[model samples]
Target: MLYKKECKISSEGFVIPDFDFDSADAVIPISTPSITQYEFDSFQLYLDLLDAMKHDKSSNFYPSILIKALKMFTASIISQKNNIPNELLESYDTPGTLLSLIDPNTDKTVFLEALHAAIAWTGAVKNNSAFSVPEFILFLIETSVYALSDPNFQYDRNIGNSTVALLRNILFHSNDAKFHFINNRGVELFSSLYLEVVGDTLKDYIIIVIINSLDVSPTPPFNFVKFVENPLLKSVFGYNLRSATSLEIRLALAYVKISPECALSFLNHIEIESSGIEFLFASTDTQVLLLELFEFLVTCSNETVVSIAEKKIQWNVFLPHIPMSFDSKLMKKTIQVAVNLFKIGHYKILDTLILKVLLEMMTIGNIKIKHRAMDAIRILINSGSPHSMDSIIGHNIISKICNFLESDRKDIFKFCFEMLLFIIQFALDGKCPRKVRDQLYEAEFEAIMEEVCGCELNEELANMADILKEKFDQLVAESETLEMAELENNHEIIEEEDYDDDEENEFHDNHFDNMNYYQQYAQNCMKGIEEEDESENESDDEEEDEWVDADEFPID
Candidate 1:
């Protein structure tokens, strides 16, 4: 029973001969007794080779030399049908076992050293072009993570430096065939290792490497094949892509290219909101990758995006993508996020988008989208924008204000009462659209009269009344001087005859405040002067003096 499958015969008709046991191979009976014994023996040799090579830097080739022999021998034994070792369920300290060489509890430092040596040995054995060795490499990768993660054995910090160097070679310097092996191996196995590691800080460095690998824009010579394309990678990535940290899918998304199917499937795989806003905004890579992902995400099915938002993403994540020239799919997503945000107490976002849409909403054709835009504008004014529109005070967005001012929502009209204050205080044009300005003026005048008459008022509405009173008093004072000058000219003859102290005192008493007094006195004096002039004309039998209406009457 050989768990390791034999390589297919190449075009060259070569079936490399196995050297461990003397029998033809059969794939299905991999866990038989002979196979079990053979695996145990190979494990023993593997540990023995690490033990022999530990202190010997003298022979530069010792690790490499040992690994080639080990690969050859293991290949031979596992290819046999009858002498294959059955699966052994043994603990770390079991005698003659691979785990015994790196037992975590006793002599922990020595155990990690032994495992590091094994990894170096694996790397040294591979030929420059050699790529996949499913069983051996998987065993090495999984074993390394297990050993490193064991609490009993603390990994040397020095080992990370060496590991980084090795990974750089595998990711950057290797041939195309080897590159696939390393990348596929990475995407397949790194997820579990990531979960086993502690803290997001360390995860950031790993994420950087993953992002760099996915950045194929300047086009690296080798194809950085997607994990979704390969069944092994898809199985492996899919299984652990949602492990207890962001490292899993964060990296998967960094590598996701143009496949809408992968994008849709991935949205379903993870709980998106688990990646916290604080954590995401904290990372430069996460931000960049998240943006790329949303660009891809919007293209996915509506059910998929909706489900993802229901689970993981926040509404704010979609807000930054809402400028005028975004994808229609993304706009739809924005609306969906807005709707959810609205349900949660973030209705302010709806207003902001609507104001933005009014500036650019002309191009959007969907009826629901337009209705949402219109409703948002009305909602915002009702919220606080109307009172505080001056605070937003001077945006060029003023161009879109007219349509909103005339909205049929009476709350809209009511809100504009305060909007007039914003315009008067801030408008560079002084004159906005005519109908709007006139209504604004009428609201101001009524508010002034209400205040002057000492009426009780709503808080904001009362404030506007005060502003209007101040403006109105200034206008009345200017009108008083004009009436007085005209009266002096018209009453010349009457002034010559006036001598009574009581009559003069009464005239002064009646006209105390300038604007109110002068307007009343001038009206009465003009009627008397007209009547005397009419009597003089009637006596002369001339009716022309009586023909004038109130329009002909002078202010004095």
Candidate 2:
């Protein structure tokens, strides 16, 4: 190396250091009475290093990306160990230097070394070292994803194991790291890779990575439905819940919200217990996450998952039991998940018990959750899930919807208007259950439509209102005929009962024949009674004739 420490003893007996020899680039050079530029030239090596990095990078980072990054990383790390910021010694581009190590083209051999270096440095720099930046974590994850995809790395299971292990530290420790990992598409790439590398070797880590992806819930979501559809993720997450570590099992609960299909894949190995429900559906801490997952899952349109969520796990049954805490953020999200479940055809989620919970939430005085609940009911009302509309009408929801229709809060007003509109259409269609529909007033709904027609409502509500008014008018026109039909039906029913009464009279008039049987039965009963009386009389006469003057002659 050009920079090294050496000393020579001259005849004068004082040690003089080599002019070119140096220990660190950031070190200050000796001062002279007249300072010259040449004596301190060595101090410029950091600039040279950066130039070299840029030069090598321009030349495809000569030899390899990992080597270039590691050298720069080593320099900064050495500087950082000497109570110096690596940026001061290694130039501010040191983190950028480490970034090259993760280029997807990195070969398997270099990648293995790179992963080890990444993992080691991750812990080494924990005391506020330069490598401890969030970008470093992102680098490791990006490298791991690339390495997992590299065909050269496929032969080496250790590469995957190391990459996944590194990810565990990065993902579990830092939310920012998790976010970067997800945004980097590490979830999907890792999900895709596990299918290749998993021979019972890396499923745990890969699944945990995808599971944590749901934690950050990265945008442009990993095609969870697409993965399940291909059986790619299905096979990757195919392992039993029993085979998973407690941590993996626990983190995987996030999947229920993200992809019920994948969660079902995990449960295929074991039956989900009540505890599973508690973790995913009942935990207030995870309510937001559960809600997020539900929000994503509904869009996937997997009926099997809906079936499991509704029937097997009984998500709806436990939902009402989960208290609507004053934490409106969670309550609002909870309402959203409930709406998602309703959308997925878990109709029982609209049961009065749960609706009561939602209604209470709407009235809880928290404007956000109130609006959220109102909007949620609006969604249910417009969901066209016969039960959604029925839910609005069946319980306290209709009143709340009507009252909120006049709310000064425009959002509530809009939501309630939409709800009332949908209910009117629902009632007009006669889709609602008789009892629930009975709770709905045609006139109240008609009046709402009339207002929508007359008011300066938005074009959409106005048009729908006009259409509904026409339908309502037609229904009203038919009501008189319908009532006449109903009267005739009742008349036919009354005549049928009178006909039955006449048949009864005819039977009474023909009762002589019936009375003959009765006479025989009565005569037989009287004859039997007379025989019993005569037998008792004869017994008494015999007892009297044989009687001694004793009062207890009956014993003889």
State the C-alpha lDDT per candidate. 0.42, 0.52
Candidate 2, residues 138-203, lDDT tens digits: the string is 665655665566766544555556656556545554556666666666666665666666444355
Q: Give me the candidate number with maximum TM-score.
A: 2
RMSD of each: 26.2, 16.3
| Highest-lDDT candidate | 2
State the lDDT of candidate 1 residue by residue for 1-556, as single tens digits.
3345434324522121322211112111111122344554665465455445443536767545544433433343444424423342121221222223434443434443333333332233332222223433344344445444656535454334224323422333234433443445654454445445554543433343344345444333223334423442244334432232334345556544434445555555544553434322323333344444544454344655544544454534434434444445445544444444433434333334334543344234355555554454444444543422532332334434433443444443334444444444433233233333344344454443453336445676557556745543443443454457668976875676665666877787775666687788999999999999999977777666556688767888
- Give the per-residue Cα lDDT of candidate 1 at 435: 30
Which runs in model 2 stand beyond 4 Å of their true positions?
1-116, 120-250, 253-285, 291-308, 312-323, 326-332, 335-348, 352-383, 431-488, 511-556
Worst 10 residues of 2 by lDDT: 23-32
TM per model?
A: 0.31, 0.45
User: What number of backbone clashes does candidate 2 have, counting pairs of residues 3 or more apart or in separate chains?
Assistant: 2
